[model samples]
Target chain A: MRGDVIALDVGGTRLKGAVLDERGHALTTLERPTRATRTPAAVVESILGALADLRRRPQAEQAVACGLVVPGIVDSVGGRAVWSENLGWRDVPLRELAARRIGLPVVLGHDVRAGALAESRHGAAAGYRNTMFVPIGTGIAAGMVVDGRLLDGDGLAGELGHVSVGHEELCACGAKGCLEAVASAAAILRRYRSRSGAELGGTQEVVSLAAAGDTVAGAVWTEAIDALAAALAMASSLVAPEVVVIGGGLSLAGATLLEPLQSRLDSRLTFQRSPRLLTAALGDRAGCLGAGLLARSAMAETVGVR
Target chain B: MRGDVIALDVGGTRLKGAVLDERGHALTTLERPTRATRTPAAVVESILGALADLRRRPQAEQAVACGLVVPGIVDSVGGRAVWSENLGWRDVPLRELAARRIGLPVVLGHDVRAGALAESRHGAAAGYRNTMFVPIGTGIAAGMVVDGRLLDGDGLAGELGHVSVGHEELCACGAKGCLEAVASAAAILRRYRSRSGAELGGTQEVVSLAAAGDTVAGAVWTEAIDALAAALAMASSLVAPEVVVIGGGLSLAGATLLEPLQSRLDSRLTFQRSPRLLTAALGDRAGCLGAGLLARSAMAETVGVR
Candidate 1:
């Protein structure tokens, strides 16, 4: 048997774990709160504990390797979590520690990049050699597959959110006019709340309010869409992907977002090829699935013709 | 014995041809006016004639293959010149035709991309796996080396010149505010001439005037540099190349261009990795050297592996 692989995706608020077989089918799944307010060492302990818990499951008995993906700047090759503002960590060697504890080879990856790999292999971006998977959540980040290879420029390549879209809003990164500052899910909700002086539960509520003819909601949503369009237009002109797979929390808006974004991008582009925009097929599971894929590749490299 | 190869770089007004050995050393070189105003067929004929002339030389007697690179949109896989506004051609199967006449396997490539390959192999960006080769001539285009592979997004990946950099000038491609519209050598000269009402001989004269404290010339030069900085900042965010090699006519300005560009890019970036700005080491011969490399790779594939 090729055996299964253990996959873990660690985000700011959640840790999603899965035991996936050769074909990337999840044999077993687990999820838990990250509780990242704890020390970086505590977070590391929690991750190891989750892996141990998953390993105890019957489906993970034959797991050949483990793949762990984390948000923020990751040194994938070095198997280090370089930096994570949400988790308050820097240069933690997660893979080496996990490999020693788990008694299996471990592969480390960036969350967004792993998600992109998963999408390219088994999700909406499958079959497209050049694809950009942009996930708009608390922040926006891009996972680019260029010429059928994931672009990892020392873990700094796919920072679409930080790129200025000619706006004036200040980003958390201390840059002005970042796409994330103006168009992320948190930004949209915050912008709406501040503009209308009304309390909103989430970005979805703002989208709903816009649909129901609320002026502030409509303006906020439109600006977000316009910002997204501007960023995508710049992406198209630079990378020229055949398609862009939109994912994360805000992607749930579906056609409400895709239609206007496509039109806006079309109007902005003159000589550049306009990429077809589609909502992500795998939803939030992409990162976990990508971890599974990473583990599988490492397994293949170890057991096959090296 | 591994044989030599014929390399041809087709520009708007020049056809640069060379016979190079396996080590990429040019044994013989030739250059002639492209006369691109003629029909596409005539252009094709001129290319074929150039190859024939190169092949007849004593140094090219044992040439195994030919690599032909041209400007405009190129389908490297399909071996077709998809489009070239300067050459006035579209969808011309130049590779297959040249192969049939030249009696050698012909590899087609985009001139700038081929130049990037040359730079990656033997020029300024030789050791860096991720590099961007931006040649600022009559127009601006980028040849990106991402993770040691030249990016080819179906001939649409590296149109950095067309990416909007918040300028209002009209571009030849009918796009307003394109980087090329305000920052290209031609654009800089035209803007200077229009503003100063002085008939300057070339871009160098404008640079000289700018150095001599001519306000109009200085403004045009500064604007061009600023626009370049904006475009490069966008590229740095998207690709995060380790180094950016600036080539083409304007690169002759050397430190005058590199110093200001580096500082401006530094100011614009927040969290992105800043790439080292370097001038092209191969000068104008990069494209021909890249063609030779392309031909060498093709030869290796034919004889060594599938």
Candidate 2:
């Protein structure tokens, strides 16, 4: 229980791993290409290799547990990766596999949810009782903490990306007007491309153009912020969280995103108290840190029962 | 602890009370008109008189606790009635006042939420882990239970009436496109009266006309069901509750409301699991039963600590 933990964050394009102390401080980190299209088994092997690499380190060799985080629906209670539409995984017994491969107890959780847990426990929302961690990057998802408990909702909850916000745009989920279709960083870039017929480099390019007084870019950025504000306001009204922590690539816009979002949310909400808006502090390391916390907690529960 | 409990359910037009056994079986029940327009203090006096009438019963003197359920944002944790626009009461320390006058421990809760708690614990939703108690009366509101815990969301969570469903009609809350504007019993009657140019007696009259194949009533009823279906479907997709218990006056429509609602919800939801639809079993006694339960639990908690 006192040793370090190895954590792996499996993303679509990257496999990120870290060896963390009992306090969730990263001792060492590693990254490799996910290569998801090349067999699911190969991706698993790569994750195992990353764990092995961490285990070879002198300090990490004494790690007590391993934590793995994956995108999509995770049946955490059953310790299985239930489904991942992006990874084409269904009913993957990820926890058992990782434990067998690593020769240690393994805990698994949804990536975004794990990241939110990390932020809530050790980062920006450390002292807040009620917090919402929303990662708005390629897609939008929220990890909600209510009364100090992270809400899993039977693995089907936290699909905040699919929540309709009255937009007319078509979403890849086959739903019209999803929050992700308008508010995610990918959505911002797509909106700019659609409006200006210019191939933008990325969301950063649109942010730069908007900052430089480009009307189309500015309009698109404004609309995205407005949509995000409305969605956040609606969530705030429903849950009344103490703080909303914005993470992922989009949050890099910092005050540019936060200022407009705060004003629009304030304007839309009449009855509810405005929640503090802040950027995530852990950045890319959040998921790994969160996974480590999960592993540590799981180990603690096991020891307590014994 | 072996005595009857006094329970009061305050509605817009009427105030109902009952002296109940420890098991929540009514020993005596009474009803009185609520003259809310007279003033807040006068209404409190009237409610006290109703309680006194219940106290006249043989079981009243044996009562150890009193429970009051009112329509409003109740600060359950603080034991205050924050606001009830319909009751015209604001920031009333209802629990403290009732406790001081009744000379017993008093517990207060939102009327619909109390009803839902009662239903979930002792009635229709007894065995279900997740349930949504939606009461479609003069207005629409819901008491949601997830993971066997009733969601109060800081006392403002159950405002299902204000959820926008693209109705494009003005609501009393000054919002356009509210679910209450289209699906509430009052809204149904209003729509029926406007379309037929005849004064409908109540929601029952509109239902009768719709059953008898009246075009105007049919259209109005269908629109109400559609709006309700949309809101329920959205809720289903988000929470995935095991069952949805329909309560309040509109639920008396029975299969007339449920059949079409079920079909529409089935059509709307694709990936989400559809919940079973059922009518509340406890009928009008639900709120009182819930209040009794709250009082009983509060008493137990106090006893446990002592």
Candidate 3:
């Protein structure tokens, strides 16, 4: 099948995109550096350039709708990007711009939420009615699916990383004890390096050292896992999800991460239903696929309403 | 107008009821002791007796459906009381039993959530689309309103009372440092009494003492407010509710509670949307009113589907 929708997952340093068939399967894919500069115009130009690149593809002719997912706050209902610190975007009319450029119906969505939608519908969280998708990359954020639908909360819900967990570390968000400051992939790597005074390549190196019996590495990992457990426990208490899908770079450690994290969450929880913890299935492609799903659903909704 | 629905808010010791007109105004009200006993059967009997008592009233002659709100982990969708430590109810088919006894359509809901629903529809949170109703009476719990709808999370959601706040007191749920253990009205009175070695009559007296410059009482109040601020901050980061309606015993303290709490929450928040914190409206009558709303809505849904 030809691409029936265009999906783009815009990030700080990269713009990943795909043209998806009706089933949301990617027919073709593209990637380019976001070329993020001080000016917001450069970011907008880059986004448009990415769309133009996709339009040159044979599959672009088949797409009737487009989904654009981006980092930071988005008022999806209003089709606006409320803010993105990385892109220096403030209340940019993203959906309208993308729709006009692509000549297709556009759906704007939060990147994490779009990934969560994709995971819930076609990835690890498939078949689960209530799911939380936490992607712990450079930072931690969540995409929640409640009663089998994405929960946007006016583009403000699912900032799991920002929730404080009583840690001593100062977070990038200028808050102390935030889960992201203590447990995110970037945080993990930075903390490990600061503690050991050794320059580590990334979160994977820290995980490997922890697994290989480096006591210092293990301690850092344990603390990160503990903070994550507290946040997850609180989340479960508020809106119990049937499954929690862990994505991002750290989840690549697989059982090394899930095993201890699950035990800590178990100890923290009481009467609340313990959720099934699983690694995300779609890998890095989750965002674009999720964008595809969002695009298709929006198109379907429009058709249904008429 | 005659009573079009019967609504009951069942507590551990009392059954409070109202006969509602089609518009949901209470045509008549009733209350009775639960007479809780050895078996779940006896408790069920007490509930049925309460319904029968209401049925005997002239106002109830026109009732076509009923709504019953109760304390416990309830699967409202499944019509079952999954568990209630207070009433020793386990796997009880509450909606079915009540429907059979009353010869009417029945809707079952969790008490805190019912109150929240009531508040959202007609009380403090009436105009807000996304709100969190946290009623800190003898215990703390939350009723979440997201995207203008109640979030049940399969009946396991909204256990804010049990969420750990890193305090010293152990919760009755067997969890230590829970919000309920440290900040509930019962906790405030008990902690103040323990500190001063005086048997206080209630939370109000403690608040009065604190207002009068009693250092011990003031300390207890400050600690409670701090815990609430942390929990609310976390909740805001995740759900970003436009307003937080605080109900229950502590709310009676009014500005004494809201003032310090608002400041603490303000300091804790980062990029998240700030929520307006207010005392709950509808007072103690919120539960029954919520039940009425639920009953009416259920009836409306039935009518709409047909």
Candidate 4:
């Protein structure tokens, strides 16, 4: 526990790693293509190779533990990846495998949940006892923090994207009208494409067209904002978090997203306190920083108890 | 602490009281009619008189605390009744007033949340670390228990009634298509009335008619159950609670409600664990028992600590 810890963040299309100090300040970082289509075992090997490369660095001998985070359901208590549709992994003994391979104690967590932990401790949600961290990227998900603790809910919680808001649009999940089907960045692009019959490059292009006063683009953007507001307002009424930290790709829209969304949420709520909406501060590094912090804390706990 | 504590449960139309020991066993219980249309001061006086009469018994002298549970939003952290639409109360310091008059410590809690606490402690949700107690009565609301702790959420959480579930039906809360607008017992009766143009006596009568194979009644029952299941399934995906305890007036429908609701919920969820659905073991007395337990715990915390 004298020096830094190694952290790895696994996403659907990319693998990111970092070596950080005790305070979670990154000393070095690396990124590699996920290539998940190969196999789960190959992905594991890639992660190990990344860890080994980090260990070969000049200060590698200072590392004491390893932390890893991945998308989808994770059984953190049992140290298993319960399921990851994106990673094609189920019941993988991730923590034990990482420990055996790296020869160091390992901390495992859900990617979004770990990002939320990072935000609560060192970024936008710091000082708030209750916060909802929602990341709207290729998909929509939330990590809820209550009473200064992240809610794992036995690893099945934080599936806010699937909460039905009744749009009647077909979702990839085989459900009609889910929030992720209409409000995520990918959904915004899809809606724009369907309405204007012009294949917009991405959500950013739609935002640019809306900024230039294109009616169809504006309508799609407005609907996405409305859908997000509806979901956030309902969540606020139920959880009353002090703040909501919006992250992921769509968040780059900034005030374009927050203004109408806040107004709609305010119109819907009657009795609950309106939570302040803010952008995530950690950006793409949140999950890695969070994993490093978790590893550091785990090492501390082990030593203190001993 | 050596004798029974006084517990009072204030509902929309009735007031129930009980004398209970530290273990929540009732020593004596009483009930009185409540007319909410009466003056608030008169209601308070009536409750005081009932408690005074109960305290006149020989076993009352050793009592050291009192507990009161009431409907609507309560700021337990501030020891104030924030609002009770049913009781016409706003910002009332009921806990302080009750404690001063009774010459003993008093605890206040939301009625449904208290019932949930009781269920988690002694009833269907017992032994579960995470539970959601949803009471679908005249209205729908929930009490959430996470990691064995009741989430008060600054007195604004647990408004499960207002969560939207795709229904376009207008709600009394002014929101179109809230869960309560479609799934509550009153909502079921309203749906039946609107469909058949016939006045049903109550939810029980509607259930009996449906059981007798009345088509209109069956349709109404089925719609309400579907709406409830939809909302509960969404909640299950987000919270992943170990158990969902159903209580209140509509729960009296028993298997007629449980069977269809469970099947519909199972069909909707894909990744989350299916929680055990069970009837609340504690009857109407749950609120008072939970209030007593709260009072006892608060007193012990305050007096036992050096």
Most lDDT-accurate candidate: 1
| Clash totals for all candidate models | 0, 0, 0, 0
Query: lDDT per residue, candidate 1, A141-208, as tens digits?
Result: 99999888899988888999988778888889888888998899999988887887888888889888
Stretches of candidate 3 above 4 Å error?
A1-3, A36-38, B1-3, B36-39
Give the per-residue lDDT of model 3 (tens digit) for A1-306. Answer: 233988999987889999988887778899998875768888988898898789779978888888899999999999999998677889999889887887778899999999999899889999999999999988899898877667878889999999988877898788898999989888888888888899898777888898799998999899999999999999999889999999998899899889989998989888898888999999988999988888888777777732
Taking the candidates in order, what DockQ does each have? 0.82, 0.38, 0.82, 0.61
In CAPRI terms, model 2 is classed as: acceptable
Candidate 3 local lDDT, residue B49: 83
Task: Pick the winner on DockQ between candidates 1 and 4.
Answer: 1
Task: Give the per-residue Cα lDDT of candidate 3 at B277.
Answer: 93
Give per-residue CA lDDT, model 4, range B1-306, as digits (tens): 455788888888888988887678877887887553577766666666767766766666667788888888898878888887667778888888777777777788888888889899998898998898998888888888876788777777788888877768888878876889878998888889998999988899998999999999998888888888877877776778888999989999889899988999887776667788899899788888888877777777777841
Q: Give the Cα error of residue B283 in candidate 3, in Å.
A: 1.1
Q: Taking chain A by itself, what TM-score does each prediction score? A: 0.97, 0.95, 0.96, 0.95
lDDT of 1 at B244: 98
lDDT of 3 by residue, B97-170 (tens): 99888888899989999999989988898898999999998889999988887888888778888887787677
Q: In model 4, which regions exceed 4 Å deviation?
A: A1-4, A55-63, A195-197, A297-306, B1-4, B35-37, B48-56, B300-306
**What's model 1's overall lDDT?**
0.90
Worst 10 residues of 3 chain A by lDDT: A297-306
TM-score of decoy 4: 0.93
> Candidate 1: lDDT of B93?
93
